[model samples]
Target: MRNATIKDVAKHSGVSLKTVSRVINREPSVRTETRERVERSIAALHYQPDPSARSLRSTHSYAIGLVYDNPNAHYVISMQEGVLAACRERGFGLQIHPCDSSAEGLAEEIIRVSRSARLAGLVLAPPMSEQPALIACLKAADIPLVRILAASEDPADGSTCVYVNDRRAAYAVTEHLIQLGHTRIAFLWGDPHHGSSSERFMGYADALKAYGVPLNRKLVLSGQYSFDDGFRRARKLLAVKEAPTAIFGSNDEIAAGVLAAARSTGLDVPWDLSIAGFEDNPFSKQAWPALTTARQSTSEIGQHAALRLMDLLRQNRDGHTDSSVANESFVPELVVRGSTAPPRSASPRAEAPAGDTDSID
Candidate 1:
């Protein structure tokens, strides 16, 4: 037998199709007796609404797409969890898609997906979040888009955003090390193409200047955001005539690499050398001495970004195109752990020390 239709249910219940719809949607205006009668008929007939037809009629979908090209597994996992939570709470669904960050057809692929899939909006992850063409393409498609951890240069088109002040967070971490008496600190940089790379490096430099330490060109090592990258860079930095007293990795993965490098080279953490990192990833705790890093609210930021994108979609559907809701950022919190401390000795000529004894005054 064919599926029962709303018309059949209404006819069987001796009510109008509109009444059945009201009952199906649980509209408060329907009387209890009428609602009960409609529900009973609906159950008897096994009537169901076509979601696709409804979506087409309404011209709105409760589904959003998440796009990213980042390789950080921790960040990817946390972001999905956060977005999933919001979707559950709001009665929505998510579709995850990975983009090509440097491919020639990147913009075309994003634009085609946005239009073809009929997505309500998109949540962009870095370094795609910082791509100008991709952003423009999404905007041209007239879909709401939220960029996570995007730089200030991207235009704010009233789309929702969740970001961290990477520069400020980096500065704070470096300052923490500086106050602990680590004058010669080394920086393991993120991908130079990424927006966070520069922001974080600037923060490190800013802290060195504030503490009246000379900016040492030899101490700054540029590396990608990965364990292997950090490992190789750390080895190079440590090979110099006089190595740094501390090393700051762009993220926890890099920090883990640095920690590994330190161990293999016989440099004890926060004893012979200090280390710190950004983005308090799970790897931070697994290291020999837990890493002291900046805590960026990855999950919470993802949740907020999803909610904001939903709001933007609602507004756009209502014929309002206010572009003021775009452009947002989050300030990361500092989590001091066992990985960082004052230099082995405050005096440059003194022998290596032990543990994180000197607090940041």
Candidate 2:
């Protein structure tokens, strides 16, 4: 049988085509009894509306665009699933487009896609969301955009964002290590260009200060958001004369690198050194000893971001609810595992860098 149309539903329900349109679009003002009758006819006939025609008539396409660039497969997958769930609930469609802003011609690629596609709104996940030029191009296109995992510096009032308090979470994670009596904790920072990198560093510094641990610039290292990047940074930290008893990575990938470096150096995890990672990725478990980490709710963050974007699309304005944005800044749950313990009294047996082992007193 041919696909059911609006005309067929109207005839079967004994309602006008306009009334059928109202029922399908879920527009208010239709009588409850009539609406139910039209809905029943639609169900029976299996009527499907053409999104293109609907857009032409109402000038509103029930579609959102998702733009993201990140190497972590787990983070990308969770974000997609969460956004798709929200889209299904709101009777909307999603158009996924990927571009690496770090690559040449990235801005042009994004502009081409956005201008050609019919999008009511867009959602972005970093490192694409953190790209200043990409954000500018989207704004120039005059589309509403929501940024996920964005930094506080990325113009909050201009573009909507769903973010965590990175500073607070980092501080909490650091304090946990300090409380375990690990005075010499090495720090591995993520890509400095992204907003999360600096915020997390501040949190780490605040925690150390609060606990009266002497700040050591030598212990802090910066790296990109890849496992390889983590590996290099961890090596540098391990090579220090008096290596830290604990290492805090910017994210799980980096922390895993620390684990590998420690293993190669013949250090027993927790007994000789403690380790903590961010984002709580699955690889944390596969390490020699399970990793201690902060659990960032990837799926929930995606869902919340999409829901807020839908609200903006409907209202045609940034949401007036401060509580909505405030509520979105989630605190990651700290999961302590086998990777951490009180520091050993005797120094590590590994081949540590030669130095005086200067005390900070």
- Give the candidate number with the greatest lDDT: 1
Model 2 residue 115 lDDT score = 63
lDDT of model number 1:
0.79
Residue-level lDDT of model 1, residues 1-361, one tens digit each, is 9998878989999999879766654445789999899888977887766545445756577678898888898899999998877766554668888877998988778777877777778888888877777788767867678888644234444445776678778878887888788888999899987888888888788777666677888888887999999999999988888898899999999999999999989987888889999988888877879999999878988988887776676567556756445556787888999998777557432222343222221
User: What stretches of model 1 exceed 4 Å from their correct place?
Assistant: 1-57, 150-159, 323-327, 347-361
TM-score leader: 1
TM-scores, each model vs. reference: 0.80, 0.79
Q: Which run of 10 residues does model 2 get worst, by summed lDDT?
A: 351-360
- Cα lDDT for residue 184, candidate 2: 90
Q: Give model 1's TM-score versus the native structure.
A: 0.80
Please give the distance, in angstroms, between residue 122's alpha carbon in candidate 2 and its true position after superposition.
1.1
Each model's lDDT comes to 0.79, 0.77
